[model samples]
Target chain A: MNHFMTSIFLILTLQFTGVSSSLALADDSIFVIAGKNSSLPQITATDLKLIYLGQKSSLAGKPILIGQNESIQESFYATFTDKDMTAINQLWGIVIFTGKTDPPKNLKSDSEVIKFVNDDENAIGYVSKQPEGDSARVLAIQKSTTTTSK
Target chain B: MDLWKNIVFSCRLFIFCLSLATALATSVASELQINGFGTVGAAASDDQSGYAYDIRNKINYYHDTKFGLNFSSRLGQKWSWASQLLVKRWVDDTFDDNKVKLDWALVSYHPWSDLSFRVGKQKLPLWLFSDYAEVGFLYPWVRPIQEVYGITPLNTITGASLNYIKQLGTVNFELNAVAGDSKVVEDRNGGIVLLANVKRAQLLTFSLIHENFLLKANLGKSDAVDVTQRTGSSSYVFPQLKYTFASLGAKVDYQTHFVWTEIVTTHVEHLSNMNGLYLSYGKKFGIFSPHITYARYWSHNYKSVRADTTTSTATTTVRVLSYVPERKNKQQSLILGLVTKITDRSNFKLEWQYIDADGYSRDTTERSTTTGGVTTTVTSHGNTKERGFFDAHPRGEVNLFSATINFIF
Candidate 1:
């Protein structure tokens, strides 16, 4: 009976490790989609930050919209900028105080961003995962991973 | 009844215009945005025996309060506008001298990706950070070295400027040209004087930056149309370099440190040549920062002409003394400062400085020798080689303490 219990414990531990590893890999793989009809070159993390902060005057020498979906963009912001929602508000406060720039236009959905970008050639935005419509294309992918040690 | 209808119509029109402006700014103008910054604080110096001396002689003394606001915005494509307002006291006994003043108002334009143009009143781009030097939030010090930067004019220009910036791999080059009229009127205790002159300025800089290393060379020249100005036409050149080493998860939170040194040579066409050297070292933590700076200024013939008047009815013949209006002055100072970030939008800083000056005195005459029962008289003139009853002046020392709060919204 003691031997039987030991074998059962080993089986459960192996299964749990496999499941957790796959979950970590899945967490790292992220999908990025453009708004409606933006033909911007693939974006890097730096480019995304610049566009959202309204620092990039134009994309490829052409002006682009600095619009984003509040909820979705908020996630990307927390992960990358260390500037969560509170930090974002403070950043805007500085911008307003300096009288240098204004807060970006916030949209509610991926579709709205798509429509806006599609309507203007200079517009650029992002959506979670790959987009389904032909009006836009995938920009890039962001990956994070977890490591476990015995 | 008619007036009521007109008022309602005006109100509606105003609301509609406001909405339309907001909509267009958000949808159409990708490059335009308006932002502002402000700071309101009280400053008091415990060193009542001495004065609070900034790089520019003395900015304040005793207990005083100062407040300032700045507004800047980018236009649709290439244009931008900026303005600043400040109120502070320059009084020795009290804060009654507080007055509001316009610090800057300028319009800037970018003609090309590598070239920018600016017109109207603009800040002189003499140093690397001159463009945003006044704003305290961006810097770790309560104030930059005032003596080195204070002598330079703060603002003047009713003309235009052209700037070119280009990048070749890791190296960036910048060139600027300014032309037009530079006139300033300082209103102090109801006394006013107008400073006018035809002005011209040029700035050339070459910068090479790589990750944690930065190197730069700056050369500047300014020519005044006339010699009536205190800071006559002068040429200034300096070179500086800095190395920064910091990364994530180091034993030290900031692990980054930088050391920078610069030497500036100032040559006024017909006057004296003032040479200055500045050295600084700084370190940063995740939130805390500390820096130390040292500067030395020396002039051969420190002839800062305070008054040049011609008396019509002179009793004696007009004669020029061999050493007239000649005096040499030297300044040495050390500053220790700290910066603390309270929140994302709020920051505060405290700093202390020690300044010493030597070789500043007027010439006086005394007895040189007495022989054969006859006393001989000797004349001691300013900057003269003759030593007649010479007296050494004690070194002037001053300690300064100041604090400031900065916020943006």
Candidate 2:
């Protein structure tokens, strides 16, 4: 019964406390990039999350999402999507087991992500730094006001 | 043979999936993707009471540990196939009858980007986390609550499912319907406790999601049979029974916080009625996620009836209806757990559970016979005790500890 009471107190305390995303993002601005020839509109954070999570097939056009398997993913996800690399992989595990969708195409580094996006007109990905010249088009992100990076 | 027909059905489905996988063979391995998940765990309890059948002072690692491999392939532009092969290591004869099994074997046709149809053996979409309930790495706990998930053994359904999804901005709406037939038996400590057979089962579910919040509602019905009370000299079988259930589930995931809850009510014609619910809250701090869950389950049987034809005359018929109270497994439990992320693909979990039982029955009423043209009605009052899950109601309480490591490849 002591445990029960302690648990109840904790539940009540947590229930009343409203928690928001605390991951700061001012230091780095990860760009949502695609091929220069692509015609994609500015996307919302939700749509970007959906596409990268393999839950959505496309946005305006048939776009193939490319994932990054490097350290940049840690900050890219934390800044844009409130989740970390571990949480992202956990979500993919369940989605794969349920036969919902296949894993996204993952590139090894920022250069690989950039090269792939520049090669395929329908390929979209995220990179730590902006692409050089006119090689790729940056998908302007419309972040929700409440979830905007601090 | 009818009692074991479900086993045969599962075997047939397994072979069907294998044959289809072989037929869709391709030299290029990348086209057919492969993914696998595994969990190794052990549990023990300090209680020496025989009531705690499997978890009494002994570290048990066989039942909770399991591994499975999933295969998925895109046949054409609109067709796809998926199959899962589950393997378990059993150190005893309890599960020797079922060493290896297939978890899912289905072919899907996406007529539209938002609509799809699948037919094969698939897991029942019963709860909030039913899809990934078995994969411990997906959840923060060592196991799902027994009060809600342990009511029956009917997890797999061999039939067809249709899903319709509509994405409106960030919010998504989905309506799913499934129809099938299945059979299974409950085995506890190598003893057959009861059996469930579904002749015709149907489920309709609707869900809505926005951001990290999800709400789901479900309704299901089955024309089935109930076989119980086999521990004594005799067993009772309620055939041609109608079982029905309705459930509501909700979950909120924002940042590192998660809250999940679900309520369900079920009824079996001429048998019993049951209600169960659970609420869980968890939060992640860095690589560790600590969580707590509270759950409860209760049941009550329908009033019984008896016919006294021996004393009936030709002019009138005598019928007696008795409202007897039957006690079943009424239980409440609290679970405290912590999940530590070892790496991106592995997790180590620990949990402490406290279970308190509250329902038991022992009849001591004596009824008068019709020896001298006398008729008596049954009584509801009985000698009551506290027992649930635990066979012996030692103190009507138990404390269990568990640890596990889950990984995906």
Candidate 3:
């Protein structure tokens, strides 16, 4: 009886933890920034998908370079595109193996992402939406009501 | 041939180094990035069957080795070029003089996000990767399955291509149109002719994403002609759709594959209707990726016809000759392969394939001739039929094992 109760408790606690972590991530903000300090056009989710897919090489006449944490590729897809990590990876495989284009360069952390994006004029990258300081600007929230318009 | 192969190999190396030195020099002078890629490998069929019965009839499948070099460079903002050189033997005798030759050369221009164009000598883009089929680094296998891509004419068109990109609600579409003339080469029947010519091909591809699902399809067509032959023309319509997913670690776990096939179909010309399909599953464990693929190819069935005439008359005797048409050609193969990433920019692969061919017949017709003082009808059809039961090539069934190493820098 005691073992069964312990098992139930463990399961409930793990489930709660998963839900809370997701909720926490939802509360966090994702920042989109350009390589230069010049005012850049706000990017929509649709454009974001295009850039990653290699379908669109540039934005506003400038080539866009996207840098994301290696692990974040899956997380970003799950949250933004409603796709499991596997589907997104497979999509990239098909493109890369076909000799169409190169895969995006992976970075270590959020700070590196900001530095890289802020350094290159044609660069575009992402970070935690709710970052601390004014290092980079948040282009738009993932699937938020306000981001629906241009 | 050996001497020539050595010379060509050295020349290729020299050119490769020269390009590298130039790229490095330019990298120091400007922000432009230069990279190099190549695949150097060899394949030998355990079965002695030649590339075709006519060519391989005397020498068998292990005539010699196959080697190639591919190089590419990025010129500047939106211009690039690439080329390939291949060296192989058609028959065992060096007198046959197998040598190295330029396969393709082209310049690519991308002006905007919505448009890119390529002009010069380029591979006919019949399928998704047909343009880069010989570039092993870009594909998982050492070579494409012969049953499907094998029959596609290996022609280089000198022309231009236009590519367009469009966005739908939740999908992206790539539109491409290519126009050019096919390269001329020696035909299989020891005749000179053009494999493809004055060709125009169009590709329409769309990718869809619904939740974790990914779906894609490509459709294309080509119209070409054989100049040397007597009004020989070629036409093809191919379509392929695939859905893939990643399962373990960083691997594409499954692929749902399908393809439609047809070649030039005409009575007077070379009429061939062949289709191939493959289902593959791949897993990537770090740098090593192992995949097993099952593919099949089949040609349209042909019926045989025979005519006979016998007459005897006292006042008037008459004799006639009749011709019967028949179709008897069928071939299939299965390939298993494993590719390992030796380094970040290098890969090595080993593959084994089983090939089976049947319904091969030699000419057997009778002719009436006058010998001495009497009329006689003689039949001539007594050629030996070679068979391949094991992986050896004396017969039709055989195995092909090959290893290849590719590098990109």
Where's the lowest-lDDT run of ten residues in candidate 1 chain B? Answer: B243-252
- Stretches of candidate 1 off by over 4 Å are A1-35, A46-58, A63-120, A123-138, A141-150, B1-32, B40-75, B78-102, B168-174, B185-198, B208-216, B225-255, B258-261, B302-324, B363-396
Please give the lDDT score at residue B288 for candidate 3.
Answer: 58
- State the lDDT of candidate 3 residue by residue for A1-150, as single tens digits: 999999998876654333323332433445566644736588888777667655566777765556766535445655565543434544444444332443454566777787767776567777654445666666656632111100
Best by TM-score: 2
Error of 1 at B95 (Å): 11
Off by over 4 Å in 3: A1-33, A37-39, A42-50, A60-150, B1-4, B51-112, B184-224, B227-270, B285-288, B300-327, B362-396
From the highest lDDT down, the ranking of the candidates is: 2, 3, 1
| Residues B1-409 of candidate 2: C-alpha lDDT, one tens digit per residue | 5346447535644764475456446423355667778888888866754323455667766446777777887676577888887765332224334345688898888776677898998888887778777788887778777777755556778899998877877778889898998766555542435666787899999989765888999999997754453444545456688999888999888888999899988888877788888999999887678999999988877654312223455444345433334556588889999998776778899999888878766443334334345555554466667455564664647888999999986
CA shift of B119, model 2, Å: 1.1
Question: How many pairs of residues in model 1 come into backbone collision?
Answer: 13
Model 2 regions more than 4 Å off: A1-45, A58-72, A106-150, B1-28, B49-53, B89-98, B226-235, B303-325, B362-386, B391-394
Q: Candidate 1 residues B288-367, lDDT tens each?
A: 66888897767654333333233222332222222224656677888888866655556677788776656544543333
lDDT of 1 by residue, A11-93 (tens): 76555333323222224334455554566777777666654543444456654555566546545565444453434654454
Question: Which model, 1 or 3, shows the larger DockQ?
Answer: 1
Chain A vs. true chain A, TM-score per model, equals: 0.63, 0.67, 0.68
| TM-scores of the models, in the order given | 0.62, 0.75, 0.60
Question: What is the fnat of model 2 with respect to the true interface contacts?
Answer: 0.39
